[model samples]
Target: MLKAVILIGGPQKGTRFRPLSFEVPKPLFPVAGVPMIQHHIEACAQVPGMQEILLIGFYQPDEPLTQFLEAAQQEFNLPVRYLQEFAPLGTGGGLYHFRDQILAGSPEAFFVLNADVCSDFPLSAMLEAHRRQRHPFLLLGTTANRTQSLNYGCIVENPQTHEVLHYVEKPSTFISDIINCGIYLFSPEALKPLRDVFQRNQQDGQLEDSPGLWPGAGTIRLEQDVFSALAGQGQIYVHLTDGIWSQIKSAGSALYASRLYLSRYQDTHPERLAKHTPGGPWIRGNVYIHPTAKVAPSAVLGPNVSIGKGVTVGEGVRLRESIVLHGATLQEHTCVLHSIVGWGSTVGRWARVEVPPVTLTPTIPEPAWTVRASSRTGSCCLLSPSWAAESGSLPRCSS
Candidate 1:
């Protein structure tokens, strides 16, 4: 049997995702048609002998988390459980804290994945590599450009042997183009290094002049403390992939990820794709429409669009590269592009919402007009280029 653990840091961690994080935890926020981490769970479930999936995080197990856990367990038919920490436990600390639970049933190895990454999780390949060498740590790595590589953990490995020779986390200087994808396969023996880190921290606290000033006992960063320190010891290895991968750090990136996943549906979930039936909505490319949604035949949607439950698309409406959330109505001829229409919101006929392409050029796209997407409870104002230019940000409308 095998297991998987997802390190989803709590609310405090995803501050970069603002209003959306306020609505739902960043990990639970919808990426394609489903919650973000569902992709991770689906990928894990596909692996043979995968028995259980544990979500280690600092969340309080609220209704959303609880409901998600239950739904995931049923959908995947696996024991998907959430392990909460009283406080923020560093990446390695949580693994060490729940070492026994993970090691239970004498499993061969377990996979640890970071919550915020979007990737074509190459789990089976990593498992094959692990079986060949039985290395304590196997990190999934991918190449990024030099400028972007500095933002991630860099790894240097032997060309033929694949042994991790050196490791650095977010170094100021460029070390290597290969960056950690925050996914790992570790054998049962991997817990020993975590225990060592814990013991060393405890000993340092006792020897310090101010014991209280020392780092907490349950604080172990897996990257800096273990991977960096253990490099060149013949324990850690890297498995490189040139597949689809990106970090979902902000809403814009989440949108980009949605596009990526939707594109993958052509092979993975073709039935989920919207088809141009004789009397249905006009479908363009890679679109997902919920069964409950009512879309007029004249409306044009796609090239990456998702219509959620009970959504109503009006006549001659144009929607592209955007998500029309549950119960939202795009009135006749209302054009929406690259924006999220919040849940239960109603867009007026002929209203248009178009967010400028995200870029670093010094120019901001000014909205030409404004549209009010009103929900039964409250209303969210989506402005055209004028107000958007003034605010210097895209506004998210929600109840």
Candidate 2:
């Protein structure tokens, strides 16, 4: 029997996300009507022999994750366990920290994945590859593209054995087309190295030194540090996959993944995107506008938009290439494109929230701007209606 564990890198509320991260933890954000991490969980659950799923992260350790788990259970119907890391552990560290819980089945092999990846790789095939090689571990590999894999690490494998030869960090040059896909199947022995690292850290009174601890306090970035170090020691393997794969890292990446997810869903469930608005809004192909949502008569929605349940779209509103989370309100005459609106958030009336408006209609525009708040609470926002002649700074709103 084989089991799997998923390590959702904790609350993404750092400087990188800023204002957007303030309203909700990054993992909780909607990636095509579903939470980003939940997508990984649902995908993992589909893999043969994945009986249980575990989410480890450094959050309040209770509230937020619990709520997410409840919603996940309701949506996915898979049993999930939320493990709170008292200490922030890196990827490898977090797994090792919860080793006992993960290895409960004492299975021959287990699966592990990064929370931020969106892929259609066949997990069962990877498992078969692991069994065929009879190696200690198997790392999923994707064909590298110019845009990606430059910043990501490479998977150097023995061409004949398919065993991971070495794991190298972003080398700044075109190294290999096979890049680490942030997914893996590990034999029991593969975890031995992690155990050794943990013991080493315990002796030094440092969880990071332990190598199996969380990120902030632990030296646990698998690609940046752990896997690279382990590769030098020679115990890892790689399994190449021929499938769609993308890293949902930054805001830009998030938007791209959302569109991709919608497109994929439309492939299997076309009716899910069907809206009976008659002549209300201009919903584009593959958009998901929830039935519980109320779109005003004078609004224009979609090209790729996901309006969550109970969301209220005001009259004269124009939303394209955006996601409106559950219970959020879009005031009258607002134009929101290329952005994500959090749950229960209220956009002021006649506001313009986009990267930036352009002088031409069909030309490329700018990066969407948000209120810059120095504190954790978030920054003050402003709304500029398209009908208005001028833009003005608006008041600050709390999450």
Candidate 3:
């Protein structure tokens, strides 16, 4: 049997995805017409012998998350569960803390995925590689440009053997072009190193009493403490993939990741992609519209657009490269381009919600347009044109 663990950090994390994270947890945020982690669950479920999937995070099992778990269990026919941490535990800490739960079924190996990433999840490929070598650690790696690589965990691997020779997490200087994709396949023996890190942290915590120190005794950074330490020991290996992969660090990246997944729908879930039909909304490319969404026939949505549940698209509205969230309304002739329309938000007639469209590239600095919902009312109204160019900050919405 095999299992999968998804590490979805708590509210304290994903600070970069503000306003949206304010309305819904980052993991629960919709991407490609479903909660972000649903894609992870779907991918995990497809792997043969996959018994169960566990989600480890510090969120208090709120209503939305609870519903998602229940729905996933029903849909996947597997025991999809959420293991909440007492406090904020580091990536490795959660795995170590819940070791027994993961190892209970004697899984041959379990896939560990960071919930913040979007990928075509080459789980089966990694599993095949793991079965061949039986390595303790198998990391999913992908190439990045030199300048963008510094932001991720870089890996140095033997070209011939594919063994990880050195590892660095977000180093000050460029280390390697191959960056860790935050997707890992590990055998049961992998828990030993995590335990070692936990015990060492406990010992160090006892010796030093610095209140300012972060990542207390229980916190274990999987990248720094495990991958970096185990490199060159013949225990860690890399499985390079030239597939759809991107880190959903900010809302801008979320939009970019949405486009990636929407494009992927053609291969994985073609039925999910909207088809241009007689008297139906004119869809240019890959578009996912919920069944309940009421879209006008003249509304043109395409190329990469996700219309969520109960959304209303008015006549002649043009939506491209955007996500119109649940219950959002685009009034007649409104144009939404390269933006995210918040839940229950309304863009009045003839409004243009857009930003200067940057050519989508594999790099991380692309501009983003966001329509932030009102924290007080849970909705906003865009009466006039709104533009956002920066990826790091949320734009002010006119209520």
Candidate 4:
């Protein structure tokens, strides 16, 4: 049997995804009509012989997360569990801390995924590669633009062998176009290196105070500590992919990822995309409207938009590349673009909410093709009662 482990960093990690993250855990936030990590769960469930999925993070098992787990367990029919770390254990530390549980049934191999990423999740290909030669670590690699590559864990590999020759995490200088996709397939033997890191940290703790004194000791950053330490040792390899992949670090990027996923639904979940009915909201491109939402026939929603539970779109309303969250009501002819309408928020008649679109650049959280937006995005956030007025000038907000 095989299993998968998702490293969902706690509340403290996704600071970039504010406001929305304030409402739901970043992983739980909706992307393409479903919670962000739901995509991950769906992808893992499709892999043959996948038995269990473990989510490792410091977030207390809150209601949303618990609900997601319960629902996912039923839907996937697998033991989907959450392993809460007592403290923030860097990416690798949680794996080491929960080593026993992971190795319990003696899984042939378990995949490790960073919760922030959005990808097509080519797991079976990695499995085939691992089976051909059981490498200790198999990292999914994808190419990024040369300038953007520096912001990620860069890898240089032997073309024929696919052996990771050198690894550097977020190097100041360019290393290679291929970067770690934050998705890894690790054989059971990979735990040995983690144990080694744990012991070394334990010994080093003796010199200081106690491992307990610091916030995290075994807090191994998988990129720097292990991949970098053992690259070219014949244990690490890369499986390059040209699949749909991006990181959801900010609201704008979330919007971007929604578009990507909505596009994918055409092939993988056509039913989720709303269709234009004889007397219903006219959908343009890819759109998802919850069954409970009420949209007027004259309203237009399209390209990339997700209307959540109980949302009411008034006549002539126009929504594009945005999410009308649960309970939000858009009065007659209101227009929302490149923005997210907060839950239960109301946009009065003729009001327009907008964010001037700009090319997304590589930055924090990760070099995600999307961006949290800089001052340009941060400056536009406006939630004033005055915004409801019928002003030709739109009220700007961060996407």
- The lDDT values for all models are 0.83, 0.68, 0.87, 0.84
The per-residue C-alpha lDDT of model 2 at residue 59 equals: 68
The residue ranges of model 4 lying beyond 4 angstroms of the native Cα positions read 206-214, 359-399
Q: What does candidate 1's lDDT look like per residue over 1-399, in tens digits? A: 999999999988977566567667889887778888999999999999999999999988899899999999999999999999877778998999999899999999999999999888999999999998888999999988787788889999998999999999999999999999999999999999999998998877733355554347777899999999999999999999998888887656766788888998898878888888887778898898888989889999987898888988889889988877677787777778877776666767666576665531111222233444443354445555445334423343433
Ranking by lDDT: 3, 4, 1, 2
List model 4 lDDT by residue over 205-299, tens digit each.
73235445545566787888899999989999999999988888876778778888999999999999999889888989999999999999999
- Model 3 clashing-pair count: 0
Which lDDT value does model 4 have at 69? 98
What TM-scores do the predictions have? 0.88, 0.79, 0.92, 0.89
Candidate ordering by TM-score (highest first): 3, 4, 1, 2
RMSD list, candidates in order: 5.2, 6.8, 4.6, 5.6
> Model 3 over residues 1-399: C-alpha lDDT tens digits?
999999999999887777777777899999999999999999999999999999999998889999999999999899999999988878888999999999996999999999999999999999999998899999999999899899899999999999999999999998999999999999999999999988887877742366656447777889998999999999999999999999998767888999999999989899999999999999999999999999999999988999999999999989999888898888777788887878787876666667567865546576634343332334655322323322222233333
Which pairs of residues collide in candidate 1? 366-385, 367-384, 367-385, 367-386, 368-385
Query: Which has the greatest lDDT?
Result: 3
Model 2 lDDT per residue over 199-258, tens place: 665566763334534323344566755577777345677777776677776555666677
lDDT of model 4, residue 357: 58
> Counting only residues 3 or more apart in sequence or on different chains, how many pairs clash (N, Cα, C under 3 Å) in candidate 1?
5
